[model samples]
Target: MDTFRKFALNIAVFISFFSGLNAQQTYFEGVYSEKKIIINNPLSADLFGTCIHRITINGEIYPFNISDNYLEVDLSLLSIRKGELFSMTIDHESGCVPIIYNKNDFKFKEGVKFISLKADGNKLSWQSQSEVLLSSLLLELKFRDKWVKIAEISSNGMGNQNYEYIVPFLLSGKNQFRISKSNTKQYYYFPVIDMTEQHYKIASNSVTKHINIIKNNKPAVTCYELKDLHGVIVKKGIDGTIDVSNLKNGFYKLYFDTKEEVIIKK
Candidate 1:
């Protein structure tokens, strides 16, 4: 009788522990093959009856209803290319919105392509091949002097994969150019003057060219070739100007004769 009682107590303890675990946020990692979709509640507690939920894609929000164990989210709503990063959020019992899943680990296949950024006056237009309805789409804009962000608008999926996005205003100065994207973390510094005309030109010459060393007026310790490094070697008295027009956009460390300078080739 004592052994039977002990067994019952052990089972009770196990059940209690299991229930506690289910009440917390869980991280799930998996891949969807053959277009198979799996929908699971992110909340620790069981969702009973009808629950209202929102689906955000690229920055647009769509409302949906959760009834059974599976929430059938239409893949067509995603308009995802072969290997694009897709994410969704869920409302929890604590009233905190949490990211349920993101395709950060997925890679695009051959036929998948994303809409490139188009420059428009002070705004950017992003068009996709499929219509995406989302709760929010974060926009990150880069300027010559500083970076600014603006939440423009939201809309429902009209079964078309095109979207027109516009930035609020220019950052501040005259030489400032803006590049924008949906992801706030990613930064693009390319110079875009107009989007309506799709005219994007490199801002190489626009960058201030000056030599900055550890000691501005000190003697050189070592001599290295500037061309050897990843920068265009614009000789002091060469043709028209330092033909860095071909250099890819980014920060490059340039060494002139014995003086080393950092050049931002945007």
Candidate 2:
């Protein structure tokens, strides 16, 4: 089938699916929250680019640019109520795409919850009260036009999900850290301190997961943590060796105190 025909068929099928859904169920109520609309069998970025020209939610149309895999939209102005049938149509230059998603696909949470945050010299720590797994907490600095993530720490499981991170070099004045659950929109951010003096040395072999850490006169913590790019904890230790023998070949960070070393596992 031609590209236009395939797109038309998809939209038709999508609309038909939603038309049959129970009219009592409404997905996008007029609640003010950031929600992600994940597309099924998503089109290639190369083909559609990042922005969608227009989005028809119910009968209202809005324009938005998708920055990543899913389209992020605000559900504040949408008149649709919960327990009612909800449908959206996205118009692109190539084709008009329609999608019907259940509540399971759209991820959203209402307001922000406060986390206990503190800074002690080059270290930062925070705690969560809920017994829910959260995404890795990321140390980030504003760079150019975007916030560049410097390091990640896992926040999985429940109870007092506390974490401590040492600050590396502050690349920019605007620095903040954030933590989130894997798929939910609930994220917590903490402001970071930009330090001028180096308190410790964090070095490691570029090819292996072994890291060498040394603290000067500062009272540094003995334990260390390992996290992937997404802030997921791979491993942690309090002993001498920071091992990554089981981890696959990828870039990782070994964090301790206010120091972090990048490790490229081979």
Candidate 3:
């Protein structure tokens, strides 16, 4: 049996505290394969049976009946494409809410472990713990709204898992990286921190004060957000020094792009 396990479902619950009532919030977990997929409920049956659960993919509804706390889907008859995204929902008299059920989020194949990728300056580094040797992989950078292919790297089968590639062109502000084999659905995102700097300084903590901002010559438009210790954003402005004279006396986090700095108000 081709078993895929441990993936979580996006469960949305609508609860009314005053009435001591809650709408159905289905928690789906477990295995999905070519022959069949099992969506098991991690919550009580009361929340589930209270609403109607349906799996809709590509505009087709595949109805299922809950048996033994799971919705078993037999794909032998359904013409569902492998690696296609789908959505789930619960319909009730109170409201109809949609849930996230993407096919790509599941691991259908075995022996494919995840690797870690990092970006420092203009260089990209990737490391894997798996002994499986990867031959060739494609690298793409997110530029504006489009994906730009930066490199197609070929690896020699010498059992070396750590690799690094330097970017030839200049990358402005912040960007994302995608590394995978060409034409395959198996791709991974490398989380990289933004290297852009926001030249800002808090002048004073008095009732009336101004922040000083030094502008840099970068093409990308930068935005700044001032967040409290609880991570609540108090104020936001375009990539420059913002006035926080009206804010409470406490420590605040200054966020611009992927960078963060802590500031205090007396």
Winning candidate number (TM-score): 3
Q: Tell me the tens digit of each residue's lDDT in model 1 across 1-266.
A: 45544653564454334333222232332222224234554443354432224334444342343334445544444455432344444333333223433333332321212356566566556554443334334454433223434453453332345446544333222323332234334333434553231121122323444322222343222122234244454433211124455656656654332234556766
Q: Model 2, stretches more than 4 Å misplaced?
A: 1-114, 172-174, 197-266
Q: Per-residue CA lDDT of candidate 2, range 25-142, in tens? A: 2224322223545443234334644323345676655334333435555444454433224465554433323343544544333222347876666577777664334345455544
Candidate 2 vs 3: which has more TM-score: 3
CA lDDT, every model vs. true structure: 0.38, 0.51, 0.50
lDDT of 1: 0.38
The candidates, ranked best first by lDDT, are: 2, 3, 1
User: Model 3: per-residue lDDT, tens digit, 1-266?
Assistant: 11211111222121221112444443333223453554543333345442334344334445444223455565443454443322334332234333334444444332233476787777888864432333567788765345667678875322226878886533345667788765466778877647554443333333234444333532333445678899887976453457777887878777554455677766
RMSD of each: 17.6, 18.0, 17.4
Query: Ten-residue segment with the worst summed lDDT in candidate 2?
Result: 18-27
Native-referenced Cα lDDT, model 3: 0.50
